[model samples]
Target: MAVSRPTILIPSFNTGPLLLETVEAALATGYPVRVVIDGSTDGSETLLEDLTATDNQLRVHILPQNQGKGAAVLFGLEKSLEDGFTHALAMDADGQHPADSVTAFLELSSRHPEAAIFGRPVFDDSAPALRVNGRKISNFWANLETLGWGIDDSLFGMRLYPIRKLIETLEETRFARRFDFDPEVAVRLAWKGVPIVNLPTPVRYIDPEDGGVSQFRYLRDNTLLTWMHFRLMIGFLIRSPWLGMRGENPLLHLSPPAR
Candidate 1:
């Protein structure tokens, strides 16, 4: 029998120089890394092309137009499945996630291949107070949507997802193709009875002066998330009876790592 291999999927859109840094860090993990360039007009295509030309472990896929983050991720996931990878670790290209923790997360996924491994961020002082506080609302809604399945942070992008299951979940919905990807996927996976594993990892918020770029739109993305939760609530109500009948909650099987 063949063992499961995991790929690191970085979905980037006009991230500029930070893209190279993020890609380098991901490759440092010695895992197969695939970067989906979501029609970035910022010359990232050429940069990535140059890098991939030199690094056999890295592969770059370019989309003709700017698709939302979730769309780019779906593209990568589909490619991963075709390439015989069983899991994909989705990470942001903005240099906020801890690249050093990739090995540990992959190890956890290897042990529990059926569960979604979420990175419960341990943010430093560099993390914006507003951003940190705003995620609480999303987390609250996620727990409610999952009937208290317990998601530590809904907005964090660093997660390890079972490739086949995640692709199936995303195919079932047209939404969650943008900034709402993280939270919506988690809730849906929980609804599908997938196990959840939370691992605490250090996160850094790179200042713009330090070459950080963020694509989150406050007005547009927040509105999308709000509407997403409303739909999830309706789905939750419909699934509650079936959910209650499940004898064991996989969420209760594992405890989040300590800070």
Candidate 2:
């Protein structure tokens, strides 16, 4: 059996100062943390200069140009694989995801090493109503596309994935390399019959005064998601028969890991 070496992965694109804070918190979890600088022009990667030099636990990879969140994550995953990591917990560089919850998620992944462990966000008042409500639409479609598979939150970025499974899933598709990454990956993983594990983690929307940088563009991103679901829906239709046999709670099946 291959031993699991799980790492916290933060993909940043012009995330400004929050990138440093996020990396620091992740490093504090005592797990190796990898940051992918996705062609960020804001020089945000510079913020981690000191730590990267001093800390062996933190490693940063830079892309020549911005390639979207999904691309950044894919880059990180490839590096993680090369570095012998078996799993990656992906979180946004923005301050929304809680750093303290990293240990719990990794611990859970340790026990259920073959499952995709998702963070079901417990939102505070800081969460924007539109963003909160918008995700419900994505969640609904995600569940439907998976034939009612258990997916607590489809668009949550803070999720743990078995590195190889996730890479194989991404390699089979090209559409999820941008804003559609989160939801699309979740739905596709379900179709592949990976077990679902959801844990409630508190999420905060950092105020602008606190140096929060949001890259989300409502119309552009939403249209991308709509198209993504449309494609997924078609794929789901073709595979529903197999997916249906996976049962309501696929985790209970717990098939042996891939060779």
Candidate 3:
């Protein structure tokens, strides 16, 4: 029999257009997967209900009101823990993540069985001119705020998280919601001694014809990130030499499987 795989959790809100492809991609990992629907007023919930009925490995959780993405993810993580899963992989419902690359990512986890596999996205030309350029700005600020700790791509959404540590972190900390979740969780995990293994995976941005729907509120989310780094920078300043001395991205030189 195939090894029982780790559960995949997708937190979706109004991702109806992308849900089918996303869930299919998650299931293609040859693992059990689930989607947590956070107050989706759209037909997305109905669509997932149908999907759940047919696939024994697929499950859905529907909430009555829309909580933030962090809340949705937390619910999924709790369920995974209850089900005795050791890790959870999170992907955006959008097609930004390459389902094909997922095998390489999961393989690494299977080997290491200890490290967090993080995706350092290799962007394609199909990517938005503005978002692409804008994220570079966020990357720079995040690296500097960490005092050049060497995070390859700070804003990439695809990441594998260690379940127990992630649960504890989420319980103790605030502000892993919205766009800030990507960077904040990575940085905090680093602080807690969870080694980050970066993998260079190609990231594609499907166009509208491919059912692309982006809900990123640039102004609002950017403001949140700026504030987040403001706090990180202050902490860095107080412990500058210490944090700078801390090593990061040590695994970047290795051309391991793409996350």
- lDDT of the candidates, in the order given: 0.88, 0.89, 0.76
- Check candidate 3 and list the clashing pairs: none
Clashes of each: 0, 2, 0
**How well does each candidate superpose onto the true structure, as a TM-score?**
0.96, 0.95, 0.89
Better of 1 and 2 by lDDT: 2
Alpha-carbon deviation at 49 in model 3, angstroms: 2.1
> Worst 10-residue stretch by lDDT in candidate 2?
250-259
lDDT of 1 by residue, 22-79 (tens): 9999998889999999989898767777779899999999999998999999999999
Ranked by lDDT from best down, the candidates are 2, 1, 3
Q: Evaluated with lDDT, which candidate comes out highest?
A: 2
RMSD of each: 1.6, 4.0, 3.2
Give the winner by TM-score.
1
Please estimate how well model 1 matches the true structure, expressed as its whole-model Cα lDDT.
0.88
Q: Which residue ranges in model 1 land beyond 4 Å of their true spot? A: 257-259
TM-score, cand. 2 vs. native: 0.95
Task: Evaluate model 1: give its TM-score.
Answer: 0.96
